[model samples]
Structure formats: C-alpha cells, structure tokens
Target chain A: MRPAAPMSIKPQADAVQLVLAALIAFALALPFATLKPNRIVPGQPLFLLDGPPFWARALVILALIALATVTWLGCRPSLRIVVTATALMAVILALGSTAGHLPPSNAYARLSPAAGFWLLTGALGLGIADGFARLKPSPLAGLMAVLAAVLILAGLFSSGWLSGISILREYQGRSDVFWREAVQHVWLAIGSLAAAIIIGIPFGLLCHRRPRLKAVALNGLNIVQTIPSIALFGILIGPMAWIGSHVPGASALGIAGIGAAPAFVALLLYSLLPMVANTLSGLAAVPRDLIEAARGMGMTDRQRLWKVEVPLALPVLLAAVRIVLVQNIGLATVAALIGGGGFGVFVFQGLGQNAADLILLGALPTVGLAFVAAVIMDALIAWSAPRKGRGSIA
Target chain B: MTFASRAIPRLIGLCLLLGLFLQPQLFEPVFRPLANTSAPSIYAQAELWSLALSHVVLALGATLGALILAVSAAVVVTRSWGASFLPLSRSIANIGQTFPPVAVLALAVPALGFGDRPTFVALLIYGLLPIFETTLTGLTTLPAPVMEAARGSGMTEWQCLRTVELPLALPLIVAGFRLSLVIGLSTAAIGSTVAARTLGEVIIAGLQSNNLAFIVQGGLAVAGLAVLAHDALTALEIWARRRTRLAV
Candidate 1:
C-alpha cells in the first residue's frame, strides 16, 4: 500500500473512476426521477435539472462536477471513495427534499427515483464495495457498517423525511399488510430451511453410509432440484389438495392445495440437494483415522459418528445451511405467485398493475433478507470451521 | 461405453424435444379429466410449441452470451500480462453471484422494461460467474511441464495459448457451461411473469383460471427440458474429457 509518487502515478484506472464517470454521465444524460400522475400510470421523466429548489439543483450540479474531476484526475483511492460516497448521500438528500417540496397538481401525483438514480446508486455501491475491499480489507467491519447504514435509513424514513418518494408512499399505504407479508416470507424461508435440515441430515447420512442408495437418492434430488420453483409449487397443489380434502387429519395439519403448505414443501424439496450433497462431501471429508481411533476406544458406530464424524464435518454442513437459507429466502418470494402470501405478493401485484414502486417494495426486502442471511451464515460458517486448511463451499 | 455415452443423451434429447413441442396436445386428454372447471383444459392463448421455443431461446441465448463474455474475460485475466486484472475480475464475478437470480430479473424491469430482453439481461448476468470462475481455475491450473515444453518448442505466447491452455481447459469450461445452462433453463419459466412468452405462461394462466391441467403440462415440460439439458451437457462433458485425454 505505498502512496504513489506524483511523477510515477501511471494511470491506475480503478473501479472508483469507472463508477464516478458512469454516475456523472447518467446524471447528465438521463432522468433522475419520474413524476407520475397516478401509481399505475407511466410517469414523465424528470431530468437532473428538473427537480425543484434552485439551491438543491445547483448543489447537485456541483457534486457531479466534483465527481467528474476526481475521476479524471485518478486521485488517491481513499479520497476517491470518500467523494463517491458523499456524492450519493448528497444527491439522495436533495432528491428527498425536492420530492417533499413538490406541489402536487393531483392527489395521486407521485415522484419516484428513476433509472438515473438507480445507476448512480448502483455504480457508487460497486465503487464503495471495491474501494473498501482494497482500502480496509475487513469484511466484518464492512458488514457492521451496512447494518448501521440500514438502521439510519430506517430512522430517517420513519421521521418522514423521504415519505414523498412513491416507493416509500407505497410502503406507507400498505404498511399494515407489509409487516404481515414480511412475516410470512421469513416464516416460509426459515421454516422450509429448518425442515430441510431436520429431514436432509439423516437422509444424507444414509447416503453416506451406502453407495447404491447414494446414487439413486442424489440423482433423484438432482432431478428435483432442476424443476423450476413455480412449476414445482404448481405440481404439488393437486396431490396436496387431494390429501387435504380426502385424507384424515390433513386439513387439521394445514395441508392445502395453494397456500403456504405447497410452497413450503416445494422449498424443502428444492433444499434437499445442497443439503445432501454437502453432507455427503462433509462426511467424506472427515479423517478416517479419527473414526478408527474412536472405534478403538470401544465406541459403537453411532457413538463414533456422534463423537467424531459430525464435529469434523460441521463447517461444510453449515455451508449447506447457508446455501439453503439464502436460496429458500429467494424461492419463497415466488411462493406468492401460488397464493402463498409473501413479499412476492407485492412484486406480482406491482407487475399486474404495472406499478414500478410496488415491484421495488417486494423486491428490495427479498434481496436484503437473502443478503443478510448470507452474511450471517458466512460468519457462522467461519466460526464453525476447525483451525485447519479445510475448504467449505461458502 | 462410447455407444451408450452417445445414445443416452440422444434418446433423452429426442424425447424432450418431442415433449416440449407437442406438450399441449399430449396433455389435453389428461387435463380434460383433471381440470374440473368449465374452462378449456389446454393452454391455447399462444401455441405451447412457440412458448417452449421462446423459453429455450431465453435460457440458451443467455448461456451462450455468458459463455463468450466470461471465457474471453477469464482468458485475458489468466494471461501473464493480464494478471493484474484477476482480483478485480473475480470481485465482479463474485458480486454477480451473490445477487439472487430472481432479484436480478426483477431489478431489470426498472432499468429495461419487461419482456425477453430484461430476462435475457438477468440470465446473462446470473450465468457469468460459474463460467468465469471455472475458466479461471482451468487456465491457472495448467500443468507446468506441458507449458514449459510448449515454450521450449519456440511457440509464440499466442500460439501456445491457442493450442495448449484452451484445449486443456475445455472440459472444465464445458462443466461450467453445463451448470450455467441448467440454471438458466430452470429459471426461464419465471420469465413468463414478465411477458417473456416462456412456458411459465401456461403455469401462470392456469393459476389465474384455477386450472390444474395447464400447470402440470407446463411444469412437466419445463422439468423435461431441465433433465434433457443436464444429460445432454453431461454427455458433452464426457466427450470433452475423453478428447482432452482426461480419464472419463
């Protein structure tokens, strides 16, 4: 990490420059926001200069110029990062303030961040992630920073600073059902993951114990995994409905054709492959001599497995848990397509109505949840790893 | 062994192609009994064959697109002169992989309006990482002695790379392509939600109308494509390994 000598600073064009250039170009050429007369109607694109308040407009122009200058100069990496982050924050604050002050011509008139804003955020997000990786090199610190930022954003919005943004308005409109849907999404994702672990571990163990069964089981699971989530959920409904209507105690057990049951079942089936495959690999990864040592200590096969094998294979198993959790969180969103209530309810609703903000409402939390799940599981997987050079599929 | 290797995929591919094209007619009778509503048993808004074709196009087109982008990027990054780009390229690929495919697909709607175009964009993004990562591994892990001999024979860097590294990496690259293609196929069904004319349309239509027959037909056809694609590529993988002189 030597500081570049001014004379020796060969053009080290980094992602920061690429990102800032993209942001500046987008701000100049594209619309920063859209003003819709109604939620479902296609909105008029509002360019960077079109947002209200001359002072805010001037401030945004200054920020863009500053970003372009830094990018052109190929300055210090840390300074570039600082400027890039500041630019995003300032633009956001400006956007919020502009939206808040807009005098609506109609009751349903709304302003939402458009493609230009997305590009600005996206490019800067990438730049920040890359810059931090090179500059700080502590993923844990980065993760904590992400949490604090999300909390601050939540606080800001709750204080109604950005309530004028259409997406936030959509959230406010459905704030009651929003929590319910969020709960359903989390329940389906985690519940399915828990079921997979409970059922898959023993199944994986059986496959590990016997080669013939392993081939058949793994192949079947592979086939199952290949089915699209919606199709799988669709296919489950008929048989499940039959069971619910005809079989004793099925209704009592909450088995239904098109509700959370089918979605949960499909998610569990989808989860089994990674769970089983990882378990097989993890069990195989355990040292043979250690198991023998346990046997020599007069341990039964069960005792040896419990005392020796599982602990050694734990990290790779946790890797499986991580994969399943992240995957289930995503697939559960599609569950709403099948009458299984989740955030996907908003996504499909948005699509059906052609309401862009509603789609964002559904999509944002799903990605965020999957992201947080991956981060937490990664931390857990790292913690569970033995102090050896063992590799797990994180 | 060779006969079976060729025949297995050919058989599955043949059956799947037929099933994919003729799914509506094939399922009409079964669905007539299954679909209790007064609505038509078969999906007829658009021909099932055309829907299936668009489905295949979305997935395969993306896979091929990802292949070209990732393979070239990986090749460049693995070159001695291009080594400095490896870490950055890997980070880019990693970021693509962390975003779930569905989210990627959804996000595309905001930037690019819905249709096959957005789905294609999402699929291309989703499929890049596996091929890039695998290609990186394949090129970087070339046997040193083989590279040495190629160099000693007075081959130019370009000539040696053309003849040696890529051929050696083909099997791994094919394996990566297989993974990417399988994922794309499975995911293509969801594209119908975005007006992409995929088989997912049948499932969606059925769900809306409360028709079970349409769902089964669509689900079975989509699943059939997945299995056939996997087997076909596995067959290709076997041939690649054999040609590359790896034990198959």
Candidate 2:
C-alpha cells in the first residue's frame, strides 16, 4: 500500500486559525453560560452576571477555557479522544462543584472581562470578515461597500446614546440564562427542523413522482400552515391526549396535556409546509436535460440522484433548511404555552410579571439568534450552492 | 366558479351571521345565553363587536410597531454598514421569532399587565421576522443593473433607492406585511388572556362557560379575518406585479 502523505498543522501558522476558532466557539458558549434563572423581572434591572465574587469568576473562566480547548481538540480526534475528554469533563465538573467552581457566576468570572471582550470581538470581527470575503466584488463595489460599512459601524459603535457596552454585557450574561432555557427549546426546534427535512423532502420526492399524492400533500401542508400556532397547539392537544391515554408507552414517556410531546409534534407539523414547498421547488428547478444526460451516461436512478440531481439541488435544499430554521425559531416560542419549556419561559414569565425589561431580555436574544442563524445559514447555503447567478430565494 | 369564488367568502360571512341570528336551535347550545336568565350568548351581542374592535386596535398598533422596526432595520442593513451586522441581525431576529409569543404575553403581563399594551408588544415581536426578512430580500434583489443605470444618470443613492428599489420591492414588502397582519390577527387572541376584548374573548368565554358555539364563532371570525387579508393581499400583489411588468 502507498504510504499516506505527511500530515501537517504548523503550530505558529495555525495559531491565528485556532484563536479564531476558539473565539467563535467561546462566543457561542457565552450566551449559553450567561443563561440562568434568578431575580428575573421586567423594568427592574436584572444583571446577567450580578456581581459574583472574584475567585468564582476566575474559576468560571478556567472552566470555559477548559471546555473550549477540549471541544476544539475533541473535533479532530478519534473515539478514544472523545472518551477521554468526556471523562475529564465529568471529573472536572464534579470536582469543581465540590470546590464551588461549577456555578454560572464563577464561570463568568473565570471568563475574565478582557478575555470575554476579546473573544466576543474576535468572533464578531471574524464573522464579518468571512462575510465580506465570500461576497468578493469589483474594486468600485469593494471601495463603496467598505466606505459604507465603516460609516455604519462607526455610527453604531459611537451611538453613545445606545449604551451598547452595558447592553452587550447584559446580553452576554443573559446568554447564560438563555443557555439554561435554550437547552430544551433548542432541542425541540432542532428536532422539529430535522423531522421537517426528513418528512418534507421525501414527500416532495414522492409528489414529484406521483401526481395524486402531490395534490394531497400540497393541500394538506398549505392548510397546516394557515392554522395559527396557538390553534395548531390546540388541535394537537386533543390527539396527543388520546395518544397519551391509549398508546402503550406514551404515559411512560410523559406525554401529558401540555409539554414537550405535544409541542414537538405541533412544531413538526408546522415545519412541514416550508420544507415541503422548498424541496418541491428545488427538485423542480433541476434541469430536465441534466437528468436525461445522467440516464444517457448509463447511470442508474439512484446514482443519478446521488451524483447529479442532489448536487445541483443542494443549495435550494439548504435554503429550505434556512426557512424551516427561521420558522422553527418563531414557532418554538409558542411551545411555552403547552409547557414545552424554553426561552419562552422568560417571555411568559415577563408577561405574567408585567415586566417590559424582562420581556426585552427574552425577546432581544430570540430576535438576535434568529437573525444570526438566518444570515449564517444563508451564507452557508450560498457557499454550498452550485455557482451561478442569483436564484429566486436568498 | 369565478363568481362563486368571489361570492363564497361573502356568503360564508352572511351565513355565519344568519346562523347565529335566525337559526337559534343551531347555535344555542354552542353560544350559551349571555345572562344566566335566558338571553342569547353575549358573543352574538353588540358587546362582542365592541370587543373585536378593541382587539383590532391592539393588533393594528402592534403590527404597525413591528413594521416600523422591521422595515427600518432592514433598510438600514441593506443601505449602509448595516450589512456588516446582517448576520447578527438575522440571528437576533431568529431569537425574536423563537422566543415564544405566549412568553411575551407572560413577560409583558408583569410590566404592562392585563391590558392591550402587553398584547401589542407580544404580537409585534411575533410578527417581525417575516416582514423583516421579506423586506431585506426584496431590497437586496433590486436588479443591480437597474440601480447602476439610474446611478449612471446621476441619481443619488437615496433617489435610486426611492425610485427604483422601493417601488420594485413594494410587492414583496406587502407580501410580508400581509403575512405579518394575518399572524398578528390570529395571535391577537392571546390578548383575551389579559382581559383585552377580542374574538379570543369569545373563545375564552366559551371555554369558561363550556359553550362550543362561542368557540366556533370566535374561531370562524379569526379564520374569516385571515382569508380576507390573504385575498386582499393576493389581489394587491397581482395588481402590483402587473403594473411592474408593464413598466419594465
């Protein structure tokens, strides 16, 4: 057998890349770390990190670095690496808890003010840089774009009245609170998105191949889309209740009246429309000649799909994922009503408590997450898509 | 069939009215008598109309607020350095959408509490993403050549945007608006939870009183509102597209 080529990751050369990756990974965790539930109310100030002891903060930072390093290193590793990392993390958290290092506040302090700021800035800067790099333009376009961007960034940064620093600090701290609530909310949203993609893509494929099924699926999804989230939740309640009562193992799984089960099912149903529509549109957009060419090349149906059609259609498919993602983010909020707990806890809690500030706490992060995800997903979709002029959907 | 299509929604509206008014036997069980004594369900009374109007006020205001924030943000992003922040903005928007509307209600309840303000706030946040995204998409898709041509003729960026981009993007923007409005309308039902009068009040009342008719009536009203908005928007879009096509 031929020997494999030498593997190389130049240490100093990789430092910049590693730092960039580390910064982003850390930023993603910032929001998670800051997410917690305590002294939360609207109007009255609720600190994201309400003045924890100094040592606690140090420990938190250490834990964050440890987590970040482990996660980063873990990515390139084999099975043994993962097993070791998991064991280490478990031990650290266990030991850390004994030494009072496990609490969120300690985690925050450990993520030193300087480090936190650096990581946050670096991640955002890199994200913007990456965005610009992808949108390569003519000199004129580049110059004009840069000038315009600088002006806007300056205004935003210097919008002294906006008090962005405090807002950002709070934002970081709230990320901790969000992290707690988002665990389930994120799961439900992702679960729904996955289910949508699975169900919708196949249905779209089936519809394309079968005329009768197409109408049924199309009309069914359309009707589903039209039903408001609350009403959809209401509709699912009855069926879910029946399932809980009659199904063999539903009760064991805690399929109660209002909770994750009904919420998950409802969100999955809600997600079907866009996923199906986008998949159908993407498949249809594939050129007829291409498929025929594949056939002429003596490729079987399966091979044609795997080789030609899907490659051409992937960008659109990813765009559908984007749509479902945005849709899921919005609809997942409603899951709060049925007790499928998530960031909605903050919103409902804020509302129930009559706290606008608290509402802002919940609402702002949600809006931020949605916008960021859409942009990132759009960028990914654009990158993955077959090179061409712009398509109908972004 | 075309005429029927046009007439059916109106006819449904009429039948719904008649079903409640003349056919007492049909709706009585569902719409319990308003007073314990023997009156018709309050949902069929003048009180319900007033309640619905109040709900409309809240919904419209919230939707308007959402529109202002979404459109302004979208325009700024597309027009200026806002582009740099687009990803972050999109992410924020996602979070907004993901943050549950009910939670907004609950969260708002504490600050605004038991009134229209909280409902308005919730609806506004809930309605933002579609309009924001659609507006952003519409603005960005302004044919670059058209903008260049206009710019070559010495039109300023603002002029180019106002004349070429805005006009072209209107249809898509309106589509987003329509979506937001429908969503806002349906979600406005949550307003009933805090005591603002709306069609939702009918449903909630029915729930409290165990009157199915009230629930049906409320639900139908909500559905009717959605269809009306959808049709109106569809018609507007057709007109706008035709006009744009003719212009081109």
Candidate 3:
C-alpha cells in the first residue's frame, strides 16, 4: 500500500477553498443590487419600471455579483470573502448615495454588511485556527468548516421561500427599528451571560468541595431547569408583588415580573445545570495522584486547587460555560413573551404581524450573539491551554 | 444496602410528600371557579392523552433519526481519513444546538404551517449534536491496543468496529443520549405554542389565566414526564452495558 503516501492533500484543498471563498463574496453582494425595488401589493408585486434608479441598482448588483463570485472561487481563508463582500456593499452604498440618485426609501436600505459578514468571518477564522490545532494543517478540518458553512447557507435558502422574500422586503425601511432592537438585544444577552458565569462558577466550586453537597446541589439545579421558565416567572410574580407591597426596601428595587428582573432570574436559573455539572466533572477529572503529589509538595488545598486543579480543569469548565452561554443567548428571547423586553419582541411581534423582516431582525441578532460568544469562548479556551512540553502528569 | 440506595427512596418520598401536601392549597384557586362541585377535571379529557401521545411519538422519532446520523458520522470520522469533515460536523452540530429551536419554529412555520411537522424537524436538528459528539469522543477514547489486537486477529475493519469500538463506546453514547433527551423534553414544550397541543399548552394556559393550580399541574406533568423518560433511558443504558459484557 506504499505506506499511504504520507497523506499530502493540503495544497489541493487550499486551492479549492479559495474558489469557494470568492463565490460566497459574490453571493452576499448579489441581492443588494439585483433585488430591484419589488413592492408586493397583497396579490401582485408593484414592479417599478424605474426600479431603484438604474445607477443605484447597478452599483448594488455589481457589488453583489462580486461577492457571489468571490464566494464561489475563494479557498481556505474563506472568511476573506465575507470581509470583501461587506466592504464592497459599504462602498457601493456610500458611492451611490453621494451620486444623488439613491432612492429615499432604499437609501437607508443598507445591505446588512454586519450579521452575515461577522458570522462567516468568525467561522472561517475558528476553523483555520482549529485546523492547525493538531500541529499540522489538517485538510479534514478545512473540509468540515466548508461543509458547515454550506449547510448554514442551505438552511437560510430553504427558509427563504417566495413569500418569505416579499415579507423581508417590507421591513427594508424599518432598518432603524431593527438596528436599535438588535443592539439592545445583544447587550441583554451579554449582560445576562456575564451574571450567570460570575455567580455560577463560585456556586459550582462550593458544591464540588463538599462531595456530600453535590447531589442536592445538582438535583436542585435539575429541578430548577425542569421548571418551565415562564412558570418560574409566574411563580415569582406573586412573591415579588407581595414583597413590593409590604417591604419598604423591596419596593425601591423595581421588582417587576414583566421586565428585565424576571428575565434575568429565569436566565440565571437556566445557566446552573451546565455550569455546576461541568465544574464537578472538571474537578473529578484531576488525577488523584496529582492531588497527592501537590500535598506531598507541601502545597495547601487552596493552592492545589488554584494552581493545579483549576488550570487543568479550565478547558472542560469552559466547554460547560460555552453551552450555557449559547443556550441563554437563544432562550433569553423568549423572555420577550412576558413583556420583559429583548430582541424576542421583534421575533414574536413579526410573527403576530406576519412580517418576516421583523422576525429576521430579531433572530439575526440572536444568531449573531450566540455565534460571537461561542467563537470568543472557544478562542479563549484554546489560548489558555497548556502548551507543548508542559507537564501532563497523566 | 448502601446509604446511596436508601437516600434515593428518601428523595422520592420527599418529593411525593411535597406534592401531596401542596396539592390542596395549589388546587384551591383552580377549583374555586368550578365551585359547583359538578365539573370534571381538565386532566380527564381525551385531549390530554392525545397531546401526551403526540409528544412521545415526536420524541421517539427524532431520537431514532439522530442516533442513525450521529453514529454513522462518528464511525466514519473516527475510523478513517474522512476526518476532514470533523470540524464541519462539530460546527454544524454546534449550530443545531445553538440555533434557537424557537427561531427554527418561527422560520419553519412559514414553510410548514402550524403543526407537528415543523416541531419534529426542529427537534431532530437540535437532537443530533450531543449524540454525535459523544459517540465520536467515546470511540476515540477506546484503547488503541484493543483495536490493534482485533485487527491482528484477521478481522475486517467493519467487523472490528462492530465487535469492539461500538461496544466500548456504548457507555458514553448512552450518556450523550441522556443529555439530548433531557434537552428535547424542555424544548418540546415550545411545540405547544405553535399549535401542537402538548403539555406546554397547559402550562401556558395556566400562565395566561394566572391559575397556580393549573401551572403546578402542567409543571408537574412535564417534569414527571422528563424524569420518567430519563429513568427509562438509564435502564436501557444499564441493559446495554450488560449485553456488551455478555458478548465479550
């Protein structure tokens, strides 16, 4: 079998990957210009023959074509296309607006060079970083990244049918609304996640030390998790009100079940299981002999925990945190249902109003928040890991 | 014989006691409206059974589908140069896990309409990653020497995988399924909002009406179902582990 020829396929893979990158660039830029001002009037689309003023539309279409071409042709550094597409769209919009032919309604209709661009860029960067993770550029890694990107795009396309397209167009003018809501939504997600991590980590370590306390703590979390979040909020409402009524100090806390407080509490409860369970698991994974060795070295329990156990356990603990963060990023939107206020308001509102653009506006940020957090967490874990030649003590 | 075993029963007894003791007070508000003492309980309706049955059917179907796809992907990626797909698989799986099942529902509702189909599709996507990740992890963790020994015994790749890798990986795979099933149980509640008539509907209804008893009833029903499903899966795990050892 000739020793399998040492498996050299990186160059071939990289070349193909470059083409795919170019194509993706082209794809993003395509709709911006070519999408012509298609206004549907319930039954038929009111197609303006003038159509977004030829020059403006031309610039948009040209940028889109460039993006699609880049996406089609790009290779290993596929995220390059996303950046290229965003830059192209921005330039096109800027240049078109200055020419005085930019349609008033479509002028604010910026080709969202934000969500899709950032997501694709992050994916490409992470995939490449991880590709070299095994100390060699693994072709298998590149392929997987490409396949995932394709799948996400496929899901987007499949979700975007004919009516879906028209619905999205309706919110072209509501860009301001979408942008404001998206920003606040992202902030809420980050704030809640930070609170969960800060509180959960210490709680996890406390439960881990006692051993006897582990079951009760873990089961309590499981029960908390099992309680439908909405019910938990409802359960809290009566007590929050009761306290607000009688307690002078509590009234000042602005303890309302319909806003940020209830949502924050519900999200924190959701964060417990993964955080606590993984913390315990990580602690358990520390080699027993290492603990003995640390003790032999005359290190205190706290010293051993901080210097030895935690460093080793960091990766697993981070994984748990990542799971919780991603989950909360998505679930927090449901908090909008109780008038707690977040991006979910747009999503549920869009649903009620039968407006696809509003739903996309809400959901896009959620996906964006989850994506950004997952990537950052992953990068942090990779960076903190012990380097080569470090003592394994395995 | 051990305190662990004894503790288990105590835990169960405590939960039961809490439920029973709280039931009267909890039911007071719900029953107060039907004070005539003539109305039948809502739990007795045929609708409740249908909802429960539909939920079970969806869960079982999604679970089975996930198992097939995840295991196959795991086996291929773990055993060969097909590992090129690993990053993609991992990322896609993560997306499935992270992609709000609610978002999936909202997006899906437009295409599939208000029903069980969209719910099942969303659940299936959400279900695959944990199982796939665990399967791959377990297979990679298998002792290399054992695999080599099996290969040296003139076994084909397929037979070696079948008789060795899979058996060794069973425990971890079971652990993965446990996680997936629990997540599915919670998420399955969202199906009710989209018109599937699941236990979530009861809970949401109770919430809308501000009825504590209904909330408790809905909450308890879903929680009970989750615990029961988890325990059943645990039993299956035990049985599978025994069977594998028996084969060895």
Candidate 4:
C-alpha cells in the first residue's frame, strides 16, 4: 500500500467558523418579510436577494461572501472578519429601519420584520461576537462595540426610521402607564428581597446553630421552593383576604387578597429558600480554626459572629442575595395576574388583546431588569470576595 | 441503610403520590367549605389526573429534548477542536434562560400558532442551560488519572470517553437532569396560557372565576408533583453516588 501522505497539521474550520457559515447561509436562503400592516396580520415575504435597494442587497451579499471566505480560509483574518460582521449587523439594523419607511405615511400600517430579518440580524451579531472572542479582545472593546451599535440604532430610532414598528407605537401610546408599571415592578422586587434577607438570615442562623433543626428547616424550604409561583400566589390569597377583613386596620394597609399583598407574600416566600440556604451554608463554611481563635481571644458569641463570622460569610451571603434579587425580579412579573400593578399588566393585557407588540413591551423590560440585577449582584460578589481575603491578611 | 428504613421514605412518597391523585375525592369535604357560592365545583370541570399526567408528559418531552441537545453540545465542546466554542455555547444557553417563558410563548404563538408546540419550544429552551452546564462540568471534571489510564490501556479516544469518562460523570449528569426536570415541572404550568393542556388551565379558570376551591386543587396538585419528583431524584442521586463510590 502507498504510504499515506504525512499528516499536515492544518487547522480545520473551528466551531465558530462553521456556525457562522451555517447562519449566513440560512439568512441568505430564507425569505425576509418587509412589513406587517398590523399586530395580528401576516406580512408579505421576499428573498433577501429579491428585497431592498440594489446597493443594500449588494452590501449584504458582499458581507455574507466575506464571512464565508473567513470560514473556509481559517483564523488568520478573524479580527477583520469580526469588524466586517459588526458592520453587517449595523447595516441589517439600518435596513430594518429603512424597511419601516417603505409603507406610506398616514397608512396606519405597522411595520414588522420577518423571521429572516431577525435571523440575519442575530446571526451577524453572533458572528461578530465569535470573531471578537477568537481575537481575544478586551472586555472594554466588546462593551464599546455594543455601545456604538446602540448609539447608531438610537440615532436611527430618533430620526423616525423605525416609527412604523408596532412595539414602539405601543410604548408611545402608554408612556405614562409604562413608567408607572416599571417603577412598581422595581418596588415589588426590592421590597420582597429586603424582607427575605431580614427574615431569612436570622432563620438561617438559628438553623445553623441547631443541627437538629437544619434538616427539617431545609426540607420545609425545599418543599416551599417546589411549589409553583402561581400556586404560592393562589395559596396566599385566602389567608391574605381573611387577614384584611378580620384584622383591624389591615385593609387600610392594603392587605387584600387580590392585590400586592398576596404577590408580595408569595415573592417573600419564594426568596426565602435561597436566602436561608445560602446563609446556613455560608455560616457552616466559616473555618473552625478562625472561630476557635476568636473564642480563645475572649470574644463573645455575638461579637464572634458579627466581627468574624459575618465577614467571612459575606461572600456567600452576597451570592444568596444575588440569587434572591434576580429570582424576585422574574417572579414579580406574575404579580400582575393578581392586580399588583407591574409590567406584567402589559403582558396580560397584550395576551388578552392578542397583541404581540404589547407583550414584547412588557417582556423585554422584565428580562432586562432581571439581567441587570444578575450582573450587579455578580459584580458585588466579586468585589466583596477579594476585599475579605485582603482584610484577613491585614 | 436497612431495607425497612429505606422503605419508609418510599412508603411515604407513595402515600403522598396516592393522596395527590385522590385529592378531589379525599379533600372534597375541605374544599366544599372553601368553594365559591356562585361557581361550579372545581373537579366537575376537568379531570385532575389527566391534567397532572399531561403536565408530566409535557415536562418529560421538554426535558428529554433538552437533555439530548445539551448532552450533544456539551460532548462536542469538551472535544479538543470544539473547546473554543465553549463561551459561544454558554452564551447561547444563557440567552435561552434569560428570555422569560411567557415572552417565548407570546412570540412563538405567532409562528407556531399556539398549543403544545409553542409551550414545548419554551420549555425546551428554558430547560437547556442547566443540563448543558452540568454536563459540561461533569465531563470536564472527570478524574484526569483515570482518563490517562484508560488511554494507556490501548483504548481508542471514543472507547476511553465512553467507558471511563461518562461512567464517572453519571452522578453529576443525573443531578443536572434532576434540576432540569424540576424546572420543567414548574414552568410547564405556564403552558396553559398558550392553550396547552396543563394544570395552569385549572388555576387560570380559578382566578378568572374567583373560585378558591379550584385554585387550591390545582395548586396542591402541582406542588405535590414537584415535591414527589424532587424526592425521587434525590434518592436516585444518592444511589448513583453510592454505586460510583463502590466502583471507584
């Protein structure tokens, strides 16, 4: 048999390249719908090659070809490919804007980008990110790219290029109510998180001190966690309603069954498992030697806990807080179902009216809030952790 | 560790399961007092067992789909050539979890035209990240020495992976499955909003009609399912851990 040619250690197309190529191919082959006249109506769709002005279509084709070339040629020009991908994404966004301007003024037609438009935009964004990742760009560089893209999109939005979009129109019609509901959503999430920390920490501490109670307490909490959020809300209503009616001045405090009271209570209960479980684990994790040293130094129980244990446990506790905060932000959306005024009001209303734009209006902000909460909590945990290590040395 | 002691937990679990299924018959007296004066009885409208079964089926379908996708992706990424795609996979999974299921349902309804398909899509997406992360963790953290020994034993790469790595990673992979299953159970209730047959329909009807009995029944059924599933999985995890300990 002829000896096989010595294996040339050539790098094949990596996952990112293959994925980007597939995405671009899918975008090219799919039909891009230019507009939908209303929220419920279906729109006319045409192939990307068939739609848009000649120059715009040419630019898109060129960008796709460049991406394909990079996929085949391998990693040598990844950075340039990323820049091209980012430009392509921006162009797609602009194209979305320009498409909105296609229908006549005073037509009351709502412009909606079709599946292909969304797919192409998403693919381009992912491709850009993948390219940047391959190049090992700084975090700040990624942030700057995102900010620049946002600014360009904002400019387009301000110039009314996307005026015909239904979601934006939904926002414009209910700006006041939107702001009110957003504020309420924040307030509900924050209130429950604060309550959970206050109650859960002490509860956790008690469980930690009494090993016998730990299993029962944790098991109870586990069961609580498993109860669906809606179920918890449902279970709370009767008790809340009874309290509002029977207790003197409770109604004045807004403790009704079908409103914020039940929502708040359910949210607090949901937050407790994470808060308490984390606190218990954090306390348990405090090194035995450190506590013994504190005791040998003649520190009292309260002093030892406050000065040493709390500080040592702070990182884990912060992690719990992070979990609770992010979870509560998501859970509070269900409060709207119970007449607790929040962004969920828009969600339910949209569902009731069969209006997808209104649903997007509510859902996007809720997701954004949850994302922001997660990021902030993560940052806090990272910041607090290193400081504790440094403080122990000092 | 004895049979009787182990049997105790199982017995209790069985009792809980029986009680949950028989809730309408068993709890009728309790619910009768709480029933709204104007509305029809909760159990009269729908069969609780059927709803519970359908809920499980939906969750199972989603969890199974998520498991296959996540495991495939995790396995591929753990391979040397696919390692660079780890961050990309992670971010994609993260986005799946970040988008609320309600929003998913809303957007999907337009394309999928409502019912089980949209709900399935939502659950599939929602369930992907946890399993994916766990599988990634399980595969990457396999004992390096064990893997090396397998390679040294004249095993091919695929055989080493199949025989050495996956067996060791089974417990963690099971943990991931458990988590995704529990999450799927809770999230599947929202499927009713999209006209999918789920326990959420009973709860929604309860809310709309202001019937406390209906709400209680639905809520109790869902809570029971979650608790039972959780306990069963916890048992499985413990068993897997023990088996692995013996094997090692």
Best by lDDT: 1
Across A73-122, the per-residue lDDT of candidate 3 in tens digits comes to 43334454354434433433333233233245663232222223333444
- Model 2, span B1-248: residue lDDT tens: 38687768667765675454345356655545323444345465445556656766777788888888888889887866456556556654544555445555655564455777777877888788888988888888878787788989999888887888878888888888888887787778767767666767776665456444454566566656555566677778778878777765
Q: Candidate 1: which pairs clash? A: none
Candidate 1 C-alpha error for residue B19, in Å: 4.8
Q: Lowest lDDT 10-mer window, candidate 2 chain B? A: B33-42
Question: Which portions of model 2 show Cα errors greater than 4 Å?
Answer: A1-183, A211-216, A243-257, A354-383, A387-394, B1-3, B6-26, B29-46, B65-114, B121-129, B144-165, B191-197, B201-220
Candidate 4 residue lDDT tens string, B64-164: 99999988889998888788888777666654555555556666766676688888887887778888988888899887787788888999878877877
Clashes of each: 0, 65, 38, 0
Worst ten-residue run, lDDT, model 1 chain A? A385-394
Q: DockQ: which candidate is best?
A: 1
Sort by lDDT, best first: what order?
Answer: 1, 4, 3, 2
Q: Please write out the lDDT profile of model 1 over residues B129-193, one tens digit for every residue.
A: 89999898899999898989999999998998899989989989998998899888877888888
DockQ computed for model 1 against the true two-chain complex using alpha carbons: 0.58
Clashing residue pairs in candidate 4 are: none
Best first by DockQ, ranked: 1, 4, 3, 2
The superposed Cα distance between candidate 2 and the true structure at residue B166, in angstroms, equals 3.5
lDDT of 1 by residue, A49-124 (tens): 7674777778777776776677567776677667777777767766687686556667688889977777777776
Would candidate 3 be rated incorrect, acceptable, medium or high by CAPRI criteria?
A: acceptable
Give the runs in model 4 whose Cα sits over 4 Å from its true position: A1-13, A46-85, A88-92, A99-102, A105-107, A128-159, A387-389, A392-394, B1-23
Candidate 3 residue-wise lDDT at B169: 88
DockQ of each: 0.58, 0.17, 0.31, 0.53
Model 4's CAPRI class? Answer: medium
